[model samples]
Structures are given as C-alpha cells and as structure tokens.
Target: MSLSKIKAPLALAALSLVMLTGCGKSSSQTSKKQEFSWSTSAEISTIDMSKASDTVSFDQLRNTMEGLYRTGKNGKLMPGLATSSTVSKDGKTYTFTLRKSRWSDGSKVTAKDFVYSWRRTVNPKTASEYAYLFEGIKNATAITAGKKPLSSLGVKAVGDYKLVVTLDRRIPYFKSLMAFALFFPQSEKAVKKYGSKYGTASKYMLYNGPFVQKGWTGSNLSWKMVKNKYYWDKKNVKIQQIDWSVQKTPSTAYNLYQSNKLDALSLDSSQTKQLSKKAGFQLINNGGTAYLQYNLQNDENLANVNIRRAISMAIDRSGLCSTLGGNNQPAKTFTSKGVMYVGNSEYTSGIAKSSEAYNKYRKSEAKKLFEKGLAELGKSSITVSIMADDTDSGKKTVEALQSELTQTLGKIKVETTTVPFKTRMARREEGKFDIMVSTWIADFNDAISFLDLLTSNNSRNYGKWSNSEYDKLIAASKTTSSSSDRVKDLQQAEAILLKDEGITPIYYISTAYLIRPEIKNVYNDNLGGWQFKYASVK
Candidate 1:
C-alpha cells in the first residue's frame, strides 16, 4: 500500500463550494433526511460475509449486517442485534437475547439468521477462508471436515429472538468473534433468492445495521449509503446519507479530496507532516502491523534459528521506517501495540531488541551467524529468495534489504522477487517461496488473531510453523476462567513464539486519511475498516 500523497485544503475548499452549490438543487431531497458517503481506496471485493476474506469485502458486509455484538470505536463490546447475552459459569455455553430488528426486506432477523450464517460460513461447501474461525464451536471442526451435518454444530435457536451457542472450550473472545463479519446474522431467504449471486452486489443483499448500502453497483467507481430506518437503534444515528468514491492511488485520492469528492482520506508520511498544519485536519492513530516474513518451510538457511535471528537483528527498524516515509512506528513486538491489554499493562514487546541498539549489526556478527547457520545446514553457501509486492515502497525496502544482507553476510546470497498482490497470496498459500514480505492486520483487536496464525493447523500458517508447546499455551489461555491466568498463559505463548523466531516482527502501521471538511461523523474503529453509517455532508 503506497500511501504517499498530499492534497491542499485550499483545493478542498474550492471543491466543497462546488459540491455545496450542487447540493442546493438537491436540497429538498437532503432536507427530508440525513445522509453522508465517502470514497475508499478499493472496491467491495464481495458482499457475502460468509465467504469474504479480505478487509474490503468484510467492511461492506459489516455495514449491511449485524451480529450478537459489535465493538465500539473505543474497542469495547456493545450490543448490536443482541440486547444482552449470558454465559454459563463453566464458560462453555453462551445465550443471546436478540432485540427486535427488521432486515431491509422487512423480514425479521432472528436467531435462525445467526445460526444459518454461522453454519454456512463453516460448511466445507462454502470454502470460506475464514472457516477455521469457528474451531471452538462444538462439532464445528467435524462439520467443516465433512464428518457431520451442519445441524451437529453447537448453535441453536431457542426461538425467533433467542440464540444458544455451545463451545468446545471457553473462549474469552467469543463475543468479540461474534462481532466480526464472518459471524454476522444471515437471512436464508436472501441467500436462496439470490442463489449463486448472493452478496455479489448491492441487489443481492439486505441491510440490518444503521446504514443501508445504496448506489453500490459492485463495480461502480462510487457508491452512496442511506440511513436504515429498519435499524433497531436508528434513532441514535445522526447522519442520513453518504456519497462515496473509489480512488486506489493515494495521489488520485488526494486529488478527489481536494475536489471535495471525499471528506477524509488516508495520507502517506509526506502528506502527514504537511496536512498536520491544516485546520480541521486530524490524524487517527489506529492499530495495525506490517512485517517481513521468511518461509521456514522452504529455506533450510532461514529454518536455522541463528540465520533467522541474525536476519531479524540485522535490520535497523527506525532507519527502515525513515526510508519508507510514514508515521509507521518501529515494531517492538509481533502483535501490534495498542491492540490488546493484559490488566493495565500493554502486551510485552521487542523480539530480541534492535540490532542497532545492541551494536550487533556489524559484519562480524552477521558473518559469524551466517557461517554458523551454513555449517548447521551442511552447505558452503545459501541462496535465500524474497518475494514482495511491486509497490514503490516494497521495491525500495527489498532493494535496501538485498544490499544490506549481501554486504553483511559473507557467502550468503539473498535474491528478491516481485509479484502482484493476488498472485503473491496464491504463491504463499502453496508455500512456493523462501522469504516473503507479508503483513497481518487485526481482524478484531485480539492479540491471539495474529499469534494463532502460527499454530500448526491454521490455514494461514503458510510456513507450516508448529510448536506443540506454543499451541498448548495458547489453548490453555482460552480455556482458563480467570483473566489474570489467561494473560499469563498468553504471555508464555508469546515468549515461546519470539524465542523460536517463527516470524520477524517489522513495524506497526499508521493509517492516514485526507478528508474534505464537508464530510462529518464518519465512524472509524480499529478492529474494522472505515465506516460511513452516521456521516453527512455540511
């Protein structure tokens, strides 16, 4: 994501005046109700939450649906369709009391909607990349493996408004998981009506949340949202409608923002410093992390703990961030900072400390480690392959890394490769490369979401990295009843993961958006993408 772009507020002022002039003719329609819309960098990949994998698809579905719970901007749990929920003392069972809400089609959204959605997401036929998210549901694993019928899964509807969920073990983040798009309620009617095309576009879906997706033609360059009268909490919604556009290039996005086509847009580092001085310009520091990954499954050299450790130690994180030119924080941990808290304390960070800090990036340490790693692998020389995106930032980072490692490590050669985003993902899934630069954004503000990916059985564990002890620690943390105990167990798991060098923690990402001043009340939560539900133009 090359986010470098800047737009002057003077240009935005002109565009806003033009937009307001146009709104004068549409004032009658605007006066009848409230509404706001904004453009995004990417198009909605898909609307079916059940099968959607990437952030873009999930964001669209999030607005059009509801779940048992939802996370607020502060990252706290809040009631969504479910007014209240109860958990058994044993922590294995959960009961949800649903609030009366009607879908966009005027049909009641019930416990059955949730059950159907959950089952559909987990069914092998659906082939959802997120199928593994239901691993804790009773018999869900079996059902996903095709050993049992969907009904065998633990979710059951007591009635139209009550839902019962049984879990194989106690998962402290169960409610948080429900808040994700994958677990949002689904209408079987909508699915059956749309058949294969369900969620492919706006026409194929229904909205149950505070905003109804309007004017989204699946492939349109722009879209709009209207307030959903059907939302249970519609009364609290402030804005009425939002107009949005799609601008993939940050430079183009900046131009749109200047033209008042967008209220706010994410800016790159260059834009940040310049825009920070502008009035009404605010930078939101959200939680997301980016990192370089070495495929332990393919490279015998990187598979050696010393080589991996030496590689991790070789990079100057602060220098790298300076070269990249963003508000990106030098990552001191595998999990992103500000993502989760244990008691009043932030999660522990720093893999092995920066090599520059320890003065260990000298050629002596690199050569020693390289020789030691090569001796262990019974090879005279090692060739490591690096696959990365072709973005300007990516090319620069890879080039710098290629130069640094080759100069430092004697007889150790590093090769760089570039691939498009989708093709790179395919190669990753097939475990086709040696070293790859990859990143993980939080699904719902949980430390485990990233940590759990390294588990042996996780599909996202492309390197097939496994440590039984690490898995046991994570599992124990989930099942433990006490928060204190769970945190301790999780800390232990984190320690093990870091010590073993499964992944090289890179840097925490800072999302920057440049918005036109006319847009107001756009909701942004760290757990999900940007939201326009309560947005309106001035």
Candidate 2:
C-alpha cells in the first residue's frame, strides 16, 4: 500500500471518555466498558478491497473484514474464517476448512464467499489493481488478462464449508499473502444488492470481522467501528467502539492527544524530535521504502541511465532523513531492511557493499555524470519536476530533493509540485510526473512485495523501467524450490536494479506516534501496518 497525506476535519466532539479508574478491577476486566479514539492523516479512499490502494483504506478494511487468516503481531498468521488448511504434496493445491461464521447481516459465511470474491477480483471487468497479486493462482494471470474465463481461475467451493485453490506454481509466501485485505471474502448478496454503490460507504458493505464500520459517507473525514455482535470471536473483542478522525496537521492532532480527545496521534518529523522522551512516544518501524520514480517513458532525460544514477547520487539521503526525521534510515536498496533474510543475515546486508557506490552521495561525481548525460542526449541542460502530496511532510520532502538536485547537478533545474494525496496517487498511476515521490509498504514480510512492483509486466511499475534479466531473476525466485537459490536470484536481481538505477531509493520510514498509556494490545504487523483488532482502552 502507498503512503498518504493528511486532510483535516473538525475535532470530534461531545463523546464520553469512558475510563475505569478503580483498584479492584484489572485493566483487561474493564476493557469492554471503554471506547478508543484514533487519528489518521488520510481519509479512507475506498473500502472495496479490489479498488483500495492506500494504507488508510487497507487498515480500515482489516478492522471490518475477515480473510482466511488475519495477520497477528509480528506477521503471525491467525485463523479467521478458516479453521484449518491442508496443502497438496506438490504445493500446487490447498484445501481450507472454514469455521462457522456469520456476517453482520446474519448471513452465513461459506466457502462460496471465498470463491466468489476471488473470481470477482480476477475478472477482467472488475479492473482491480490488486488482481496482479493473484498471479500464482492457476489461470489467474490469464483470467485477469482476458485470455481465460473467470470460472477457470482455479478456486472452487467444494461444499458450504470447504474451499479449494490450485496454484500454477509453488508460492512460498502464499499463506502470508492471504492475510492481506485483497484476499478477504466478500458477501455476494451484499455486492449484488448494492452493485456500483458497494463499498463506497460503510452502509453499503457487510462485515464478518470483529467490528462493523459505521458513519462513513465515502468522502467523510470521520467514522466509527463498533463491535460486531455476529462475529465469531466477538466475545474476545474488548473495545466497544473505535472513533476515527482525520487531522491534517500534526500540531492539531497533538493538541487533541494532549487534551485526551484522542487515544493516539501520529507525529511528524518535528513532533518526533520534540517529544522523543515523552512517556507515550513510540518509534514504529514501517517496513517500507520511499523512493523517486523516474518517468522513463515520457522524460527523455530520465531515460538515460547516467542521468538517473546522477540524480540518485546527488541527493544526500542521510541529510534528507535528518531534515525529515522520525528515525528515517537512508535506503541502499529498494526493498526495506529486515523484510527478508539470507542465511544468518538480513538480505539487504548481503548487497550493502555492492550498492554503496550508487546510493552514496557524491556531488562532484554526480555533476560529472549529469554533464556527460546531457552531452549524450545532445542537450546543454534539462529541467524536471518532482511531484508529491500537498501535506506538510510532502512539501518538506520535495523541497529537500529540489535543493539537492539543483545544487549538486550543475546546470540542471528542478521543479516541485504538491497536490493532495489522492491526486498524487492518480497522477503517479498515469505516469504524469517527471519524478514522483512514492512509498511502498510490503504486503507481507517478503522482498518480492517490493521487488515485483518494478517488474516489466507489473501494473504497479508506473515508471516503466524494464530489464529482461531482472524480470527473469524475479520469475525464477518465485518458482525455485531451493531456499538458498531463491535468495541468490533475488540478490542478483536487486544488484541489476541498482546498477541500472531503475529507481532512486530514498529512505526507510519509521513512523513516530504518541499512544495513550491506557491503550493496550495495540501493535503492528511485520510490515508495520497498525493492528487494533485486539486493542483495548483500560
């Protein structure tokens, strides 16, 4: 999922702050009597799993939807709708035994829900951006490409409670992938009833998870997630209601936190530094990488490898991170650190030395390379604009990049444009910018979640960077049975991507937040996406 910029709404008003402050009862004992208030910078773009592409929407979906498995603390797979699953010996087939569950509307959730959901997402008419994620499932790629019928997409409802899935090849991370919101089951009855209006707002959707969303009007900046009575695990749910609001400015959100109006506040760079020692402060490692995506197809200057490399080397990533703090780390590769491992070490560690030259800041070398690239293109100089969100942090990021590029690369002009988060995302998808500042959080704890986006055929490869060898290595990594061989293939692929400067890795993001002391069980998945399913306010 992509990162987002904040939008402001009026402060949530007149809500009771139900707190239990007695000595006899433990925090857990009083949890059910409390409500939690949370803040987000962005609005929910869409609740429809097939169309939701931003982190905000995905996080909200996780709260109200149940997949086969739910991602637990540290990326552990916890059973949701599925009680158990068995894989075929060749690893090409999986059969799941679903537990008895009921949707918020009191409809039984069966294997047919899974079958319908999968088919709907992969159907060519659905135009789902996430359909590419179903690549390994048998005929999924072909179905999405309109080369095969939707019924041939390899998933079936064996019975009311049993579901089967066949894969075109072995997928090592298949189980983890199921934890994503895109794999969640949808109610066919609700979808058909609502049709085009489905998932546009909370009222149009059905929930089978721990919570049922309400008060969302699609474009509204506030909403509520109330405990779902029909949920199978409702007895274990503590928080009775979660009030969510959007606060565009960090200071505004911080004020709400200080006044007890909010249970949590996401901090920006300045706030992180100012409140580092605060009691409720936390630094969350968001297993994602922010980078500069060059428009190779439209921008002739950016099409030159030397120019791309020069732009990459011109920016001092360490300085940039210092400017925009929150414990951001300079990225040496596109994949974030700690997502994958090779032998006893992290995968990024293996390629550190090889990637140093390209990632390191060297103004003189960058200028030389920039000049040579201009000469090769038969131009004296060139101007390029960088686009980013219009929020405070987004402006800061693009300004820093502009300063670095113009100062380091002589005779080059750098421009900047800041738009709303949604607009920026749309422009990026259309390849409408010279360089777009993009952030990608891993869908799972695997390097492929980041690497596969830049593949030639990937729908997310907006920059249009293509390399045959890179594509081959990525394809091989997916099908290889040997764990060590897969690592080697991925490592070599990363090296090629860096050498060619397909994209300029900026920094690894670590978000800072101030969470109330009374809030408990709130945690993040392995990929750093927040999880509040089990959260409670004491």
Where does the lowest 10-residue lDDT sum fall in candidate 2?
7-16
TM-scores, all models, native as reference: 0.85, 0.93
**Can you write out model 2's per-residue Cα lDDT over 256-287, one digit (the tens) per residue?**
66655566766766887898998778877667
> Which 10 consecutive residues of model 1 have the lowest summed lDDT?
5-14
lDDT of 2 at 310: 92
Candidate 1 structure quality by residue, lDDT tens digits, 170-268: 887888788777788888998999999888778888889877877667677566667788888887777766665654345655665565444555555
Could you say which candidate leads in lDDT?
2
Which stretches in model 1 have alpha-carbon errors above 4 Å?
Answer: 1-37, 214-222, 238-246, 342-364, 378-382, 389-396, 410-420
Error of 2 at 390 (Å): 1.9
